[model samples]
Target: MTQHHQPAPAPAPAFAHAQDGTALAYQHRGQGPPLVLLAGQANDHHWWDGVREDFHTVRSTITLDLRGTGDSDKPEGPYSIDQFADDVVAVLNALGIERADVYGTSMGGRVAQSLAIRHPERIRRLVLGCTSPGGPHAVERDASVRRSLAQPDPQAVRRALADLMYSPHWQAAHPGPYRTLGDPRMPAHARRAHLIASNGHDAWSELPRVAAPTLILHGDQDRLTPPDNLPLLASRIPGARTHLFPGARHAYFEECREEAGTLVREFLLEEG
Candidate 1:
């Protein structure tokens, strides 16, 4: 017997406009409580391709490239975390979504924090993964990873990102994501602007002001943000909790999609 699988439901109202008139490209998938997915800094929407099916399976997810990456407008330099937050708001408004559960990874987590602090009413629950709360006190990655980000060639840049993002075993096990990971739309300057924006992101004082329930997820083997940052986030934000994934790196969600999805779904539904 030949059995055909049912096609997944599509998330409608794909495109949206940013406050600065930048045409932000976005896609919505699944159905339930609206969940906005913010990617890492300098990472396009495609970065979430591996684990998206898990999150989208139970709830509506809004995934978009934050201005400088992917198909989003790469206007000049001087981008800030606040600006990225506004871009998220623009997309939610365009979709007529009043509030949403937010899940952000790496630099995208910075954007989520800014949104929660700046626009508290817009978020239902916050999920931050493999990111840092920047400032003079913030712990940084190794110098080599920083240098890799500044590389002139995109291939080298991606290679550097992989080194900083994934554990060696994970890489050897799954090579397709990196092999096909290529985005020519992001210029070097735009990536620099993203790094610049991420600089001095001191949410230390502002985290206490975030009014939404929060969950912080991190990988034990993460080299970029370091697993130590997880405790800082959980302690700073009021009533925030954390989850640690052993043997996982920065891309913990993707590495452990099935488990992560169940945790997230339960949190959003039961906690929030």
Candidate 2:
């Protein structure tokens, strides 16, 4: 007997205009309490591909492409973290969502910090994964890891990223292709702008103002954003909690998606 599997529901895509009049692309998927998933530096909504399905089981996710990547407008540089947060607000407004839970990783986590700080009323719960507060207070990765990422060859850089993002055991168990650092579709200028914006993020002084309940997550083995940021975030964000994934790397949420997703869902659903 040939059994037929139902096709997965495609994301409903739409566009919203930021305060700067730049167009941002967003997709809505699943059905439940709203949750916004923000991408990392130079990445698009697809950055959540690895773990979105897990979250979708318990959430109605809204994912958007920040100004400089994917289906969004690629405007000129000097983008700020506040600007990225505002862009997210624009998308939420377009969807008529006043407040929602937020999950962000890497640069997205930085943006989430700005969002909760700058627009306090708009966030219900916050989850930050593998990200930092930046500025002088932040912990920087090792020089060797930095050098490996800065390699001139694109393939070499990707290989280095793969190692930083996944564990050897995970890689050995999964013999498929690995993910890249950023969106290949992003223009060079936009990527540079994203890097500058990401590097400029500094919310340490402002973290105490975040009104929403927050959860910080990271991989013990993460080298990209480094695992140190987890405690730093939890300590600064008032009443924030934390979780560390053992043997996982930068992509800990994906490497241990099931466990990560369960923690997130429970946190978001918990009473204030």
Candidate 3:
């Protein structure tokens, strides 16, 4: 009989906390200026696993699983963007960080915007990746997509993950990570809560209040938050700039991690 071999399992990430005692999870890597990364909706801190190595070349990186997701505490609904922003501040405080650059994606971008607006003292610079100001134009996800997300069917969830995260060619050539996105641990309630936070968010008027130097990154091929939205965001915030990644989708960071990290590192290092 032939001998069989099994692959070793990946090590699980670490956990931390916000000042409010809400359990939060995060993975820390690298060794320089701190850069706190807030991940997109329905995802965990591990979402940054692919890019963490790249970021370490420039600065220390911390990627947190926001409250109610991944290894974090799943406090009941009624969660708001403000609450999430506070969570970021609390985490910074708990870590004894006076200030750090912030990078957020999708829903995470909204939270980063809120942090800049409400807790400007904590943020040194801001990077908004594949996100939009929650307004009329931001409501671009198709009704069928919304319906499928609402149903909580396993197959539907898998398809939705692929549609949101990758281009057709990428999906066809590499489907493993996309399929793992439907891991049973991601509950319907968490998805609903994330949607509630995204839909209820209205940061358009608050854009002008963001004082930190900001960089808005958008994918030209992003279906969820269209590229047009990036200009609107750039125009509103003082000293805000925008970048469009060609042939990239909403998961621009995952698809172009090194390029994105390079852009972000250069932007954050710029002196005003």
Candidate 4:
């Protein structure tokens, strides 16, 4: 049987002051146990639009723009994943939240790893979506992803993003969403900093320390983050669970949005 959930009300955007005085812009869409949604590099909280309503139906959905993206203050850096983790905790503290279910995708996942390892008490559950724990042993992006990221023109970048985001099947079934993801509004310097920070992420040594209930989601056909590297995450995170969407590409979260939400809902809510 198909499960149904009420759509979340319109999003309410707000700002929380991070420890370093960076103002992280976040949006709240529901009311319940905080379900924090972190976005990948270049993207912001709006990245969760496809799945937000589903999760929001049961949990208070908290979506935040990491340091350099969206409305968040973009300080010149030398940024690290740990700094991002600290920013997340600061946001929670500013909101008077003691504990919340955390969900991070792509680069956000790296930040999530640090959060789980460093501030276990702040997380009720952990969901790592299409992200990696970078280091020497990390899996690299495929040639296609490289080619896409290397595109020089805005049109070229858009085309590459569309290709990177959707599977052929998904694109054929749903037309506009994938094409609409214009490049994330980041200046050249800020973009470089985010990439640098992402490269500096090395949490393999720290994964074993995560204490929250964890779920790992990835795409089998993901060209950006090699799906083959996912097992290392699951094996290391105490009792972490994983789900790989077949034939799904980098934007598997959208390709499998409903399933992703259901899986998270089940894990967070312990639903039957």
How much lDDT does each candidate structure score? 0.81, 0.88, 0.76, 0.81
lDDT of 4 by residue, 75-155 (tens): 888778899889988889878999999999888899899999999999989999888878977888867778777877877
lDDT of 2 at 190: 97
**Off by more than 4 A, model 4:** 1-12, 179-183
Misplaced by over 4 Å in model 2 are 1-12
The better candidate by lDDT, 1 or 3, is: 1
lDDT tens readout by residue for model 1, 150-247:
78886787787786677778788988565214355789789789889988488988899989999899989888888888998888899998999998
- Where model 1 places Cα greater than 4 Å from the true spot, the runs are 1-13, 151-154, 179-182
Best by TM-score: 2
Q: Over the stretch 1-272, how does candidate 3's per-residue lDDT look in tens digits?
A: 11223322444656666656778766666689899998777777766665666666567887777777877887777677788888877677667788999999888898898899899999999999888788674546667656766665767766776676778877777666542253245666766787788778788887899999899998888876777879888988998888888888888886765677678878977886
Model 2 lDDT-worst window of ten = 1-10
Positional deviation of residue 27's Cα in model 3 after best superposition, in angstroms: 2.6
Report the lDDT tens digits of candidate 2 across residue range 1-272.
11223437655569999998999999998799899999888888878776776776668999999998988999988898899999999999999999999998999999999999999999999999999989999998989998998899998988888899889888788754754368889998999899899999999999999889999999999988889988988889999999999999988877887788889988988998
Worst 10 residues of 4 by lDDT: 176-185
Cα distance off (Å), candidate 1, residue 26? 1.3
Backbone clashes, candidate 3: 0
